[model samples]
Target: MGKVTGFMEYERLEEGYAPVQTRLKHHKEFVIGLKVDDAKVQAARCMDCGTPFCNSGCPVNNIIPDFNDLVYTNQWKNAATVLHSTNNFPEFTGRICPAPCEAACVLNVNDDPVGIKSIEHAIADRAWEEGWIVPQKAALRTGRKVAVVGSGPAGLAAAQQLARAGHDVTVFEKNDRIGGLLRYGIPDFKMEKTHIDRRVAQMEAEGVTFRTGVVVGEWPKGSKITNHAKETVSAEQLKSEFDAVLLAAGSEVSRDLPVPGRDLDGVHYAMEFLPQQNKVNAGDKLKGQTLATGKNVIVIGGGDTGSDCVGTSNRHGAKSVTQFELMPMPPEQENKPLVWPYWPTKLRTSSSHDEGCSREFAIATKEFVGEKGKLTALKTVQIEFRDGKLSEVAGSEKVWPADLVLLAMGFTNPMSQLLQSFGVDADARGNAKAGVDEKTGYKTSVDKVWAAGDVRRGQSLVVWAIREGRQAARAIDLALMGCTTLPR
Candidate 1:
């Protein structure tokens, strides 16, 4: 840990952001990173808390305190090593993760926690700048092949780990490019795609093959997604080709609001809207592009996806942006004493909210008001929490005009067709049926097949997906070789 008195002396210093006016012009990362000196100062805030709850709080179990101490002492290279020991992609989590570790910080019991995420971002960026991050090529090849479906965080992690374990690894992505949601679902304003590009290079160097624009299963002909691969191989064909199959396909089914006029022309899922912007940012010309210019935008279902829609709409030069959340607004502050070391209920305003958007909570949408076939406005009502239930209050109905609506309520489950094609059993929530038992590890009901991340656990953070993927890699390796050296 850093100096014992460091936490007592230092205050948290966070990364800066570009002005909204300038940043809204394009889709790019706006969070200004900390200088080395500033990052060192922030890292010094890590105290010797005897028990590090931050480690447990992090899904990847990143060696947070070790890296913090390394950064504090100016050991930049070692800091990156410590971070990489647990997390395969600190850069991704550093930028997009909500930092649950901060919520579990010892200092957070009373004061601001250590700037762990900022320190992580600095270490990763510094490692890249100094050329310390090189490919970790396995010394020996096992001649065993692994096929990982989906190129999201989980699949990438599993492929990287399996490759490093000397197993031939190949990632299959249906999209025209790799990096699944990282390249599509997430906006560039949060994390630039270059981070993913560099990692892809590193993985290639480590002997991982990427098959882009080749889908394993047949996607419906009229999918909202147009720019993807034609079906390349059947599920049985992949099983016959590879020694093992890892299903890391994310929860792709977006939950819908089945209210009146749900099929309006202007109403679209968040995935439909977000991915187009990301493609445009990547220099792809989207024919019949969905633009938010000159339209009043309304994003429903309060979550990261909704927030991202708000930010993207603002960048689209929308006339106005509004966000609606069905749940009641949380308290501005959490009661630390009661909820310490656990995620708490509190109001969190993302950088997107700061970009300019009217956020409404405790409101439920009754219907989508539209003219002809396009959405025109939304009929909503104010609600209050009572007896552990939300009830609409009388005489609180209102109408808000809008031209576009983005439904971002979050994903419900994995696609049933894909799961059924493999004959894998699904849990009640529609995720793959897998147990945490050490004996079976991350294996599915189907032999030689495994599931991890969102497909197994439902909607969760990217870091958790990485953790599951890494763990599943180790499990698959052990099952294949009767032993594994890959880190759990």
Candidate 2:
């Protein structure tokens, strides 16, 4: 460690945000990351624990202590190398990951944990600025063809790994751009699309081919999630053309609230509203874009997506925003002794929550009340869990005015039609059936086909998606060459 007593001497310093009023006027990243010196100091706070739980806590299993020590010793370039060894896209994770690694930190038992995410953000940004990040072209060609479907974190990671291993890798994205959800679902206010674009350029240089606006299988007809695909390539074509196929298409079907008036004009899935804003940010003219301007917005479901809705609505100058959560409000702080070194149940207030919004907990919408086929209000009631069953409270029914209702509930599963087209079996939860064991890791029910990320594991964080992608790539490499040097 650079400073043995650094933990005792320093307090946790979080990245700053732009002023709410000023940031609302434009869609851009607002997080002010740590300076070089500050990042070094933050890295110094990493204690000499016998086991670095932060490594296990992180989905990608980043070498946290090694990077922390490297940063503390002023070895910025080496830190970036160590970071990239585990994570293909540290910039994406640094900006959006919830940092469960921090929750599992040794220091978090009694004090604030090291600012790992901020340090990672700094290291990646500095690496790019110093030209430490560049294309890693293969030394020789493997003469194998790999088709990776979807261009989100998982697919990108897999394609990069396979390409670096000398395979002819091609990524297919249904959206007009390379990044699947990252290019459209996430708002620019969180992370600009330039990050994705830069990586796409790097991957292209590494000999990975990107085919945008190309769907790999039959998209379900009339499915809202299939709106972006301009061209469809049958599953048979990919199977016959490629040596192997990796399905990294993320879970896209948003869970629906099948209540009365769900068919109302103003009621829409969060995806329906979010992608339009991202497209507009990318300079695309949306003829009938969904906007929250001067309207009473009601965001159903308390999660990252709901918080994103809150932030986007505020940026659109909504008259008012209210978020509803079916679960009861959690404690402000966790009981450290009871839940040490693991994610704890506690209240989380995002930057969006701090900006402005009303949050309602333990509330369930019974019906969407509207007039003339347009949403107007919601009939809701307080709920409670009793004897492992949810029951509505008597005499707690109420109606709230709403002009736009955004259903921000999480996704249920991947588009089943795509999986079925390739004859891949689905799990009980509707995710692709695949095992993560070393013997048959990421292999789908169908031969020569594999699945990873949200499509295989259900919806999850970007960090997890990257991890699955890397591991799946290793599995494919092993299957192809009878051995693989790539890390699992």
Candidate 3:
């Protein structure tokens, strides 16, 4: 709880963004975070609600109110301590998380919710600047070894947690660099990869070993899942080598549009387009890097990936950018009373949208129009729901010129070949079927093996991945030591 009557006295403040003209020139973070005084004022707005749904709403279960009060009282050191207690990387969630915790804020019932995210961002940045964050080397080493496949948030979180718990942790990443989804899936404008780099350094200091460019199992052909893997390790090798194993890869099987001209050049998955730009930004020379410069870019899908495409395209000096949404657009604002304390269906406009992009809702891409194996345009039609069934509207079909088409339709599941190589069983949705239960605890059917994050639960938020990773680490520690002190 913050100030007793602060909610009634102060108005909500939001994080600022750089102007489009300046930001479009480069792919770097443009967010202007709250200053110390501003963060204190924002934190003061937190009310002492008897039931704090925000805690439950957060995937990492951050002690939002406690930290808010600490910030309000200018107790930055204690605030950082409280924050780092539950969440391993508040900086990641602070920048990229949608802040479901704010949506579930007690004050959000009627007024603007507390600026929890902005405050978190401020705290994390300040903590880094003040040199308060450092590697926590474990005093005692457990002889147990944990092999975490994938260097995304989930794997990284699990690895860090296990390392802090005094276990030998080695993380495997197929990509040449670490941070799987965060490294490639997200655009630099939204979250600079440096945040990930610092954490990796900290984890390394903590004795966590990260082996990048090491692919576990088989890398599927024609996969857009960013494989710069120079080496390979079989599942059997890991199972025999490590005392325990965690399959924490991201859900990277992009959902394909099975339409005519699907194989046309200049059309690619969002993952493929995003990673190239990231590589380029990092000074990596890509021979045939996909370019949207001077081209009419059509981004299919209105989710975060689509927004990222729009932003990346704009940075590439694209002639035009248009995003398509299959479902009808929701209301501009959610009906709060109807969907309080939960994620609501509402039209979300990311900074990418503000950077110049046209958004079309309730549309379907029927086919890709091409000329000589090169993409030219998209044959699309407006869609409508009738009798609880989707049907295309008549006389609404149109062909839009598109020199570059990016499929941001999202992922279906983790790489099936990789999962199959490990003999992991997937659920109906093609996610590894592992439960977060007291008995099973993220364990797959295989012995001494566990699954967590997107690979097990399908594509989800980074916060969720961190939570699953931490919890699974606790489970594994308990399984290994018979008893554990790690938090769930």
Candidate 4:
């Protein structure tokens, strides 16, 4: 809102990416963020609209216009302040989030939307460079302890909020290190782990204790899902030790393809494949690590996870990479008038896709063809919508050779054993059953036990997890001290 006519004068600027060849050589952030002047011009594109749908479109409800105006005015510190006030970690969202806020921008009805995400990335980075970001240590201690299981975005946000509100917050992570998916599930090229490591340091300074390699509940031995828990604490132990318990363990059970040859040696879950690469990047040695080098790769699923698989495979120097999507390809552009101010069904090509990969839609994997108990190829068929149901096209079946197959079909729910240990109820989708009302905010069926993020909502974006974490912190704070100043 710096200039009423600025939206008409400035064009939306997009963030740049490094060359594919250079980036494919290693696992690192390839996004070239906006410069100070470039961010200012982008922010200036914010219109003087009476209502900002971007505010609501964002899962964490970031103050888009206020920050935009701040950036336009060159008040970089204030922009960071406004951004951090609502969202705990702007850096994470600024880099990896699809920027649904931009989709719902007022100008997006016809014209190109303002570059809100790029502005946010600039502000967050500038804050770090200028030493504007610091630990917010509470003056008083409530002496009440909160045990949060999972060190994902949801758990981290809640722990920070609770700690800032004078509650003694301790986060328990089963992995050998913290950050959960942020550390392992996400590819480093999208967002480096330094972003998460810094936040962990800040939270530690704010009186939050993180217990890495210590699982809250027992993980099933010999499970396909990997675990690095060095120790375990029971549900009863947490109930007795802490004033409140938050079950924020993210959804970890990946959906599997139950076709023939599912037990083949080369077919693996996307989670299994992604975490190892990230761990290796962090200087951890993984014996017999999965490598795509010189092998034909086939990835299943069309979501963000699938895209990540493609990017990681390219980095692995795979011979050939092909991605499969069960649904028909979407229109390249959305019909704005019909779906105004909301996420639209349209084809989106990620930076990963641009790196190099062939994508096929309306195709389903009929079977995994293998020999000698190892993956060899895939039997697939073209499908189409008929009578509101997907049916196979006649004479469309084909077999393609594949040495490795990564299943990125997405997660079904939080691993059940962890929830069951605490007597928590699960929704039909196998996610922890919890409500987000004034009275029942993130509360599980068991008293004093709460759940949030992907554990409660099934698979979702990082921004949504942050929202639930902050809200649940408010709820826990109120229950513990009868009032809370934490933002909901």
Candidate 5:
């Protein structure tokens, strides 16, 4: 807990952003982090609640109160230590996470909650600047090896935890670089990829081996998922080589809109559009790049993916950007009394949304209109949720000019072929079948093989992925060494 009277004394102060006009010129992070004194004040807003719900609200279960108290006392180093105790990467969550902890804050019952995320961002960034964040190499090797597929937050967290637990760890990524969604799915404007690069360096120093551009599954036709493997590692090979294998591969198969004109030249998936901009920002040459310059862009889907598309399109000097949501619009603010201690329903306006865009809800795209294989417009209709079913509103049909269309409807499941290749049974929603049971923890049908993160749980946040990775690492360590000291 922070100061006893701090909550009543201090008002909330939020982080700032660069003007859209200046930031639209380039693809880079424009977020203005909180000042040290201001962050301390914000941290002081944390009340001494008898039961801290923020801890449970956080996916990684970060010790929020302890860190907040430490920050209030200006014990910066101790704050960093406490912050990193549970979260493997607070920096990532600070920038990208929707911060459900704030929703669960006791003070949020009546007013703005404590700025936990800004304080976290400050702590992590300060730790790096003060050299508090460095590699902690294990004293002795456990003589156990773990092969983790995918270099996303889950894979990276598992590898780090297992390596620190004295097990040899190797992380494989299909892309030419590490950090799956962090590197490619997210735009640089939100969180620069350098945050991932530095963490990769630290993990390397901690004795974790990273093998990039090594695809783990069978190739999908006409898919953006790349296969750069010089050689493949069969499930049998992995079972024989490593003591245990953790499948941290994320759910990557994007949901598609197979409506007419989907194959139009100007239409593309959000993943395809987002990653190319990231690659270009990293100085990589992208052939046949998708640009929104001087074009009317229509981004389908109202999630974070659609927000990213809007931001990217603005940076591309697009003529206009519009986002569509199938569901009805939510209230501007949540009913806190009814939804307290849980994520509430509310309309979230992201920084990307603030930049520039038209947002429409309760709308459905009937079809994509195009001319000679090139996208020209979209046919849409308004819909209403009635009698537990969505019905099209008569006389609400309309056509909007669209030179580009980006589908950001989220994902359905993990890649099936990869799961089948390992003979792992999939759940009803196509995720790898695994449980949190200690006896059979995170293990699939096959012995010596396990699964975690989105591939096992379903499409989720990076913080959830990190938690799964750490928990899976603990399970694997326990299986290999007869016990594990790592936290679940």
Candidate 6:
């Protein structure tokens, strides 16, 4: 809108990155953000499409065109305002989100999509630099209390929204710090913890209370997931103390590969391996830490979690890294005309893959081979899908050397114990049973109890979690006061 022919005039400019060698040495953010002028130029590329598919394409439904126009017109503060209107944490999504919004851009039909994520990243960074971000304290206290379990993006967003609506909000996290998975599951190399810390500070200033190292319900014994809780508050206590309870406890049960030698000492879930390094980065000394240094690491799973394993292992100076995917390799380029306004199936090479990795596609691991209780190799075979069923190719068996194996397969469900403690019904997929309607959205079978994010929907992106949290908060606020001004 700023420049009529801006899309035709300028080529897409992407965020730069630190060289592989230089970045692998330290766990710090390596993305070089767009400069102010560069961001303005990039923002100018937003075509004045009557219908902005990018808005619907985004999980949180961000007002893309408004922010892009604001940025192009040098209205940095207003751009931040428009951004924060829909997204609570642009910094987080800008850095990690796959940018499905870009895929749906009108210009993407034939040309590169507008650099929306980069512009958003710029707006957020500039907002912080200019001190535009601050606490939005409530005008009056609502004489109600809310207990939000889990401090991940969902919980944090809900707590912040509820607190701003004048309710006393307390967020309980089992981990030693706030930010459930964002603080532990994601490595510091992709996004520093400082972003979470600052947001926590802002929320605290807005009257949201954070209780870390406090588990809201019983944690299963011997669970591989991280839990640093020193205190456990029973569900009865939360129910009796708080007027409303919101469960944003994320999906934590990692899917297991129940193959031979899975009990090997060197085979571990990605959650177990990732959280230790994050703790180490936070200056905590972990005993018997899982390290990939000088070890041949085999990461199973082809999702974001697996890519994360690749990046972290490389940072650990692994001897070599190989990733396995049961699915066949996708096309390097998507058929844009066929899938313009929706997410397309295509090959995605992450920064970690670019760093270094041997990616094997359509490969299935039949067994984990080990000696003396320690994993040593993997017995694998090429697979093909016939009649929608996977079958191993004949004479394609091979044994690959491996010192460590990380199962980066996605999570199966939220911790069942926590949901059971609240007497919440679970869906067929093991998510908390709750509707998304405006009247009964997020409300569980139990009165005064609700669920959102991964607890209600299955494991999803941070942006989706934030959207669910915000909507759940609005639902709770309306249920409490019979009306609410909070955005959905």
lDDT of 1: 0.91
lDDT of 5 by residue, 28-57 (tens): 889899999999899888998989999999
Worst 10 residues of 6 by lDDT: 220-229
Per-residue lDDT of 226 in model 2: 61
**lDDT of every model, 2 decimals:** 0.91, 0.93, 0.92, 0.93, 0.91, 0.93
So what's the TM-score on candidate 2? 0.98
Model 1 TM-score (2 dp): 0.98
lDDT of 6 by residue, 1-488 (tens): 55678998998999999999999999999999999999999988999888899999998999999999999999999999999999999999988888999999998989999999999999999999999999999999998999999999999999999999999999999888999989999999888999999999999999999988787775577653334457789999999999999999999999999999889999999999999999999999889999999999999999999999999999999999999999999999999989889999999999999999999999999999888888889899999999989998999999999999999989989989889999999999999999999868799999999999998898989888999999999999999999999998
User: What stretches of model 6 exceed 4 Å from their correct place?
Assistant: 219-227
The candidate 1 region of ten consecutive residues with least summed lDDT is 223-232
Give model 6's TM-score versus the native structure.
0.98
What tens digits encode model 1's per-residue C-alpha lDDT throughout 1-488? Answer: 77689899989998999998999988889999989999888888888999999999999999899998888899999999999999999999989999999999999999999988988999999999999999999999999999999999999999999999999999988888889888899999999999999999999999999998776765566653323555566788888999999999899999999999999989999999999999988889889778888999999988999999999999889999999999989999999999999989999999999988999999999999998998899899999998988899999999999899999999999887778878899999999999866787889999889999999999889999999999999999999899999887
Question: Which order, best to worst by lDDT?
Answer: 2, 6, 4, 3, 1, 5
Clashes of 3: 0
Candidate 4 regions exceeding 4 Å error are 219-227
Clashes of each: 0, 0, 0, 0, 0, 0
Q: How well does candidate 3 match the true structure in TM-score terms?
A: 0.98
The C-alpha local distance difference test score for the whole of candidate 6 amounts to: 0.93
Estimated TM-score for each candidate: 0.98, 0.98, 0.98, 0.98, 0.98, 0.98
Off by over 4 Å in 5: 217-228
* Candidate 1 RMSD computed on C-alpha atoms after optimal superposition onto the true structure: 1.3
